[model samples]
Target chain A: MRGGSWRQSSLTGIGVLFGVTLAGLLLLPFFALAISTPASDLLEGATHPLFASALLLSLRTTLTSLSITVVLGTPLAWWLASSSSKTARVIEVLVGLPIVIPPAVVGVALLQTFGREGLLGPALGSVGIALPFTEISVVLAQIVVSAPFFVKAGASAFREVRPDMLIVARTLGASPPVAFFRVALPIALPGLLVGASLAWARALGEFGATLLFAGNMPGRTQTMPLAIFYALESDVRLAIVFSLVLAAVGMLLLVALRFLPALRNFMRGGNA
Target chain B: MTSWQVIVRARRGELDLDVTFEGDEQPIALVGPNGSGKTSVLRAIAGVLDLRDARITVGDTVLEDTSAGVRVPIEERRIGYVPQGFGLFPHLTVLENVEFGLSTGKNPLQSEERSRRALQMLSELNCASLSERSVKHLSGGEKQRIALARSLVLEPAFLLLDEPLAALDATLRRTLRQFLAERLRLFQGPSITVTHDVRDVAALGAQIVALENGRIVQQGPLSLIQQSPATEFLAEFVGAD
Candidate 1:
């Protein structure tokens, strides 16, 4: 019995060591960044007007992109969840390709689709609509890269919902939209929010695609991440400040996500 | 009075199902072993499954008749279905789960009254105290009651319950079966309950339709079917040991 207890203790010790090491590797950078920066520097960074404007523009674009993603991706996700058709699977794979392809390749693809000399350009021009090198272009770029995240997450979330629940709702006399909003959406909300947050964060920090397609025009197209790039060239302190602001906002969202009721209930359910 | 004559044919994997049944103002229990196409019969009636040749009639209404090419959407069918596994909306509270079927009306009180009626049904089942709890938090027995309340609140012309107690524990199963029988007695309209348990037939005293593989092998009063089971499978299924 003593030997068995010793074996169990040693096994537990090894497991704890492995878990701690993995956590340390993942969290070390953020801790180091925070510890190395003086509180005074962080405070100074927080007060800059340029930082504020970049922050505002980042927020605006991220929100707009997130809205557009939810609007377009939700119905598509629902369809993908409910459909057993081979064609729907093909469409699902096509939507997922954006996430798999490198961001730089996505930039190139977007330019090819919407750039001045590209496909749909002449038609848009005929309608007097220009897409590249503007705030709208920044939103478009973010949507191109980030929308897939929402779609993928939303689809999986919807798929996790049992068809029986939806059937019960319909039998109870709920229309398709009513059943979706009441039953499917609420059940899928936690995942949808997590996906939205991840996509929003990705869009806010997007650099390669924005630089390639939207161009780095300050006050018009330059978001915080782009501003950080330019500020690093001109002033290192300003870049650090921008980075600090971005980190703070990201942390705030992560913290706020915990407060979501659906997530709370989901966690309380313990793997239900 | 509502009446139904349903015939559907569907092939799924190794199972080929061709079933025909007629009922009016009586509860029919489809009792069979696992994978005997009992649930498939219910699904076909609910219009959740497409059949090559299906002819379903509720009263004078022709819900589906593939011979004449008429298929009504599930939403407009006026049939309440409680699928196996409770199928409670995990995100909604018990009251909300029960209220879901009633919330579609233009008058809010129509929904409120329906919800109240649902609560009363839950109370009758001794689950009213769990009204504020999320369906996900409810015990399996509680979820079953909520699923039943949700279905019955619609006041549908035809009710279908597919293995309603299959997900519960053995202890809960026996108790809920009794409660279910009592509830079914109160429902004046036609209902079809599918189950694998022979005890359900004895407890409910329902008209038994015994199925094997994908066909109805024997069907009649529970006493008649119990005493003289037609097939060897039926003899084994009715617990003739």
Candidate 2:
């Protein structure tokens, strides 16, 4: 009994030690940054014109990319989740490629596809359009790198929906589109919201692709992350402050997400 | 009156079902052991399932004639389907769930009238008090009532209820079975209900069809089927042995 009890307690002790160690490891960098940078500096850097525009530009482009992804990804997600076809599986993988590929590879691919003398460049030129090194390119780059995450998460959300409910909706006189919008979309909103948040965060922090595809132009393509990179080269304190501000914004959004009652209920029910 | 006339030939997994029944506005009870394709029969009529050699007609209109390549889509087919799980919209209030059927683009009723009609249906079912409640907050019996109210508000040409009260507690099942029979009388169309209980047959059915091994073993009025069991399975099913 003594040996057994000692072994059991020792195993539990080891588990606790590992758990606390992992938690401390995860929080160490954040803790260090918080103590190193004063809150007053964070507030000041957040409001400065250069940092402020970058923050505004990041929010604008990410929100735009997220909106575009939601509008396009929802149907794609529903189809991927519901279909039993091999072709659907192939399409899902194609759509999901960005999540596995290096962001730099995606940037190079995007530039090749849309840059001057690239595949669609001649066609775009005929219509008097240039896409590279602009805010549009920034949004496009973010989308190319981040849409796969949204699609993957969105597909998972759609998978949780019961197909029978949609069938019942159809029998209640709702056509396929009507049933999808009025029934499926509402029930899957929480999952879709989670997906949107993930995609939004990913788009907000995108660096490698935007740097390659959308050259970091201040007041345009230069987002918060890009701003932090440039700030670090010239002034270490400025970079630290900007990084703290971005982390704070992200934390605030995550806190707000938990408080949304509908999502909370859906998530709770889902677990049950 | 809208009648459910379907000759369904289907193969689900290993179960090969070839069953035909044609009748008027009387609730038909499909009683059988599990895996007898009872639910498949109801699903076939609801157009939520694809069946080989199925000829489904509502009155004279051919809803699905697989031979002639005529299959009506689910929305166009006027079927009120209550799935096995009740399939209520969890995110919606009971009133909104009921209002959903009436607010369809194909529904002629305006938004105001649709709301009024949905409320009246809820009130009739004694579920008006629960109308503002989210469906996730509802008890099984309450959700069942709301589901029925939602289905009935459509004034559907036919009702397809898959083991309606199976999810409820025994006490609630008995109460809701009687409640369903009373409510179904107001519906002009016949309902095809799938059940494993003989009491469900007595409370909710005017006609009963016994299925075994994916085929109808016997069918008639509930009393007739119960009194004169056609096979050992029928006798066992109706508790006559």
| Model 2 residue A265 lDDT score | 62
User: How would you encode candidate 2's per-residue C-alpha lDDT over B1-241 as one tens digit per residue?
Assistant: 6665889998888899999988899888888888988888888888877788999998878889998999999888888899998999887788889998777755457878988999999999998988777788788999899999999988788888998989999888878888988888877587888887888777766688888889998899877876889987778878832
Name the top DockQ candidate: 2
lDDT of 1 by residue, B1-241 (tens): 6778989889867789988888887778998778889888888888888798889999998989997889987877878898888888876778877877677634335766866887887887788888878777678888888888887767787889998998989889989999898888887778899977778877877788887888888889877877899988778778642
Candidate 1 on A82-107: residue-level lDDT in tens?
Answer: 89999999999999887888878878
Best by TM-score: 1
Q: lDDT of candidate 1?
A: 0.83
Candidate DockQ values, in order, are 0.52, 0.53
Per-model TM-score, in order, reads: 0.88, 0.87
* Top candidate (lDDT): 2
Residue B130's C-alpha lDDT in candidate 1? 87
Model 2 over residues A172-248: C-alpha lDDT tens digits?
Answer: 88888888888888777777887888788889889999999998888988998999988888866778887887888
